[model samples]
Target chain A: MEEISKSPVSDVPTLADVAARAGVSTATVSRCLNTPDRVTEKTLKTVMDAVNHLGYAPNYSARALAAGRTNMIGAIIPTMENAIFARGIQAFQEELQKNGCTLLVASSSYRQDLEEEQIRTLTARGADALLLIGYQRDPQIYEFLKKRKIPAVLTWASEPSQNFLSVGFDNRKAMKELATDVIGKGHRTIGCISADTATNDRARERVEGIWAAMRDAGLEPDTLQVVETAYSIENGEAAFQQLMSGANPPTAVMCGNDVLAVGALRAAADLGLKVPDDVAITGFDNIELAFVAPVPLTTVHVPHRRMGQLAARALIEALHGRSPESVELPTEVRHRNTL
Target chain B: MEEISKSPVSDVPTLADVAARAGVSTATVSRCLNTPDRVTEKTLKTVMDAVNHLGYAPNYSARALAAGRTNMIGAIIPTMENAIFARGIQAFQEELQKNGCTLLVASSSYRQDLEEEQIRTLTARGADALLLIGYQRDPQIYEFLKKRKIPAVLTWASEPSQNFLSVGFDNRKAMKELATDVIGKGHRTIGCISADTATNDRARERVEGIWAAMRDAGLEPDTLQVVETAYSIENGEAAFQQLMSGANPPTAVMCGNDVLAVGALRAAADLGLKVPDDVAITGFDNIELAFVAPVPLTTVHVPHRRMGQLAARALIEALHGRSPESVELPTEVRHRNTL
Candidate 1:
């Protein structure tokens, strides 16, 4: 663990040293390091032994230049601060690594402009393909990828006719099912806390799904109260407090996602109301917290790992010059103690 | 949103298109794309306009070859499935992007071998610098990074003398302080739940810190029962239940992290045991969930955002050939309803 000098002329062994130690040509050593599968087992073992003994590290830039591919993929998520996207992105990155591709990740904080900027930055740093979340984006982004010929796949929402490779569950349908279940539980009045719907199609779709289900169950859309808030516990708490302060509070609350639901649950507890007895609550995205909440949260469980694995597979297929089929994974209601 | 071919020869616009549209040399266009400051503003604007108009995207490999720096920073963490590392890494990436550097993230899944492989892949993918979560790692990884002269910063534990940059809290001391507060609250018999301590320095340090605090307060270390468990809610509940089932059960429980404490809290509620009345509980790393738990958790708050910002600044400084100082950020106890 000694400090090594920054200069290139330090005592550290170079690729030439490894080649000399392995008793092979420099090109053979280079081939072993860059394309190990192409080398014979005997040669690969010898080169790797020499590498271990001499501690020769490959020059990444030089190797990337020679190979014409960095074997890297870039994934741009909206946020990791929330667990909603973190779990799926983790699975996607693991799948990519298993296939010998490294993942470069960036967060856009739910800003379309920032996402566009990160896409360019990731591509400029030698990502062989891109994995983007959601299908809605600036049209210029699509054009940029088309002009670059970068294999890109979108996840977390599916729109087959858009022609983008999508691996996701139907967000709209998931919310509709959850809303229907709430109605079946004998809750006529429903309140909703959702992220702003103007620019976020997923949020808009979820809100509309709830409206559709409620309307179908004979509840008026106007009677279904809704509040738009940022996706954070603090915001959720504030929105819940506001909802409860209304002259007529709804008997049931449906949150766009689990984080907001957790917040609403906390708010209810703070107000000295018993969950399910005084008011029932429901959440989408059955995250880990939902299972461990004070009261197990009844939620919609999206197939996070499946969607991620499919997205990686699709992107890799696209990179290999094959058209990957889009997939719409399933979502199910997890019955728990809350509702 | 059209399905495009993978080959470079598809309908994609190449750099030649930008050159033609701008009425400039291809070399000029390349230089304008790679090093904007080197070109005149008028010519740079013209090239950018053409790039936008034709949707021309620069090739990553060619750009990395022309510019020695990749503008990519690599981070290797345990898992994103848990929220412990998510917020900090998210903040770190946000800060890095402000300086025009993208983050390349990989998860080791808490495996030493996977971590080593990920380090190699990220380095091979042209990460100019690295941000590792902990100080402990395979010796070969240290040797490889040293041989390559890559600037790396360790996080989650502070070790300044290693000559590697670090931005983290004192894990051992923070736990000791929390244990002291528990003792001060007149709780002698304590049970601890921790992740496997052998490979995880963070968990081990917290456990040892509790033992030391107990010993200092004249309590035998053996009297404080310890349970090693995975950092999951279901596992935490099982462990807590087992502890409570034992004869002479502890009056208080100390968790290695908030995730474990959360499970313990739920188990207590399920058992009809009141927190701090029947049994007291404490947690480390005060995540957002801590505040929203059924009984607000009393825990140590690590400055996640500050740690991220400092780590990014220090790593960026080191990349710029400046010696960045290591920082051991402070942690404070937040008193709530749990303990």
Candidate 2:
């Protein structure tokens, strides 16, 4: 058998090679790469041609040294696959871009330790500020922020004790209002689908809000059904199915968020249960999907975009040495077909 | 009324002041802030107190000079509000984190000009490499990346002419296969709900692929009706309503993506039409919602996580001076209840 001819491996060039090819000083070449706008068009084109021809790659470290700020802001959220923080973070990024900032986002997946590690990485990478989801975290994390003097903003949950600028809706109060609406619908037997409360303060507060509202209405906590699960449509569907399959199924199911509510709706349909007539379903965080569902979802609408904008503004202001106050935006329930 | 006494504004202390307060050299304070691992636990506490008391913020520009690399990567996607890029980008970020790289993400919101601006901003912020969605962008962007010698990989679409490395699926071929399946279902009249094809090469390719498949099946090009709109459920629903309300409504609707397909399904339900019975529906990019839809959507499944991982691996290899070849992953049709 004839031996196969192997393809030759191509080489990637370095910044030094580009500088040599362009017949310019390394600093000039670095300047051209770091601030193209500062370089003349003719020199810029020449340097660019040499780079493309040689397949040159700039050294990021050296470039970072020359530039004062890394165009990065670190944002630690619970999850991105879920819509809860996704939209708000997206909005936050948009606002950041308007101010010429890039957002470095990471999902802690709801682990406090992982979140702290992410913060360290972000700081190492020279992130100027941080946008964290909730105020609840290890005291060491707060101490680290204070020690580093990094401007950090909290979102999704607001805690007065933290003394950090926060842009969020009152999670406990929002849930309480949502539960009141559910009870007003004459749902004495209420079922709940919440995120794991032990780790997620937001989920804990939401469930507590519901329980508090039910108790005030003269309904015992034991009468309310509760299932703690992750914030996922599939999990929501499973939780709803489990609630319905129980000996005493709830007449109304109040979900921790819209995602769970959507799953609950799907599960209810799968079980041949008509919403409103057979089992009323309610969701929180009135995400866009709530409006688009087969039966419009009755849920609490959070001004997520506005919150993101405010958070960005506050962080930017803090960066400029202006002390910005924390903001608590409002949330209201939208009555729809499901409820 | 007594004039409100303004809280005395403390002049923000400099790094020198923080160093003096902590009884450490400026270099020590810098080391403590930059690389805490190098500082003793006792000294770190002292530096932290000084930092918090003085409200001292590190001058990022000075710090950037000392650290050689920014340890940041910039990823520009079309939009985060849309789930199409969500899972893939999330996977990309997860993989990058393992390599000790922070991802700076920006959304262009589907605007070419915005994309260019984001590219410039990311480059200026010292992104070692860039991750871009789709190959179709202003040539200037390519030139800019080349000029800056920023290693960038184009995703979401595969094209050979582009010099940039790519890890993506063949949108045209995938759509052609999906269209073939639609034609095989014995449906002569086909309608399409696509995002604005004018600017989106992916959208255009999908529509053209369907046209090619239909033509190959001995159907006239005019038989393939199309409605262009944004990639949103609400917009998708509107397009489906328009298509169904037409004089010669299609017996089947093929959507450019699953989000649009979901909308079409909802619109069909609203119009009292059953899926696959009255009108079959097919979609592209089988997202999570595709399987969970009331009628499981017949669609094309793109290996999003794999693509993300492959992209990150390629970028890292390139960064390490290895010339990685362009990769094109495959896509397949997922037949479900919709068709």
> By TM-score, who's the top model here?
1
What does candidate 2's lDDT look like per residue over B1-339, in tens digits? 011111222343678999999999999998887688889999999998887666566654444434433446788998877676878888888888887677888998988888877786776666768899888877766876765556788888886584779999888889989888888989999999998887888898889889889889999978788999988888889999999999999999999999899889888989999899999999899887787676888999999888888898787776666789899999999999988
Question: Which 10 residues in a row give candidate 1 chain A its minimum summed lDDT?
Answer: A1-10
- Pairs in clash, predicted candidate 1: none
Task: Estimate, for each residue in B1-339, the C-alpha lDDT of model 1 and write its tens digit.
Answer: 012234544566778878999999999998897678799999999999998888776665665545555678899999988787898898899889887788989999888888887787777666778999878877777878877667899998886356667899888899999999999889988999998889888888888889889989998988988999889877878889999999979899999888889889989988999998999989888987787677889999999888988899888888777889889999998889888
Just chain B of model 2: what TM-score? 0.83
Clashes of each: 0, 3
TM-score of chain B of each: 0.93, 0.83
User: Please, what is the TM-score per model?
Assistant: 0.92, 0.83
Per-residue alpha-carbon lDDT of candidate 1 for residues A1-339, written as tens digits (9 for 90 to 100): 011123343575778999999999999998898678899999999999998777576766665555555667889998998787888988898888777778889888889888988888777777778988888888888888876778888888877366777888788888999999889999988899999888777888889889889889988878888999989877888898899999899889999998898889889988998999888888888887787677879999998888888899898888778888888999999989888
Please give the distance, in angstroms, between residue B162's alpha carbon in candidate 2 and its true position after superposition. 6.8
> Which pairs of residues have clashing backbones in candidate 2?
A61-B68, A61-B69, A68-B61
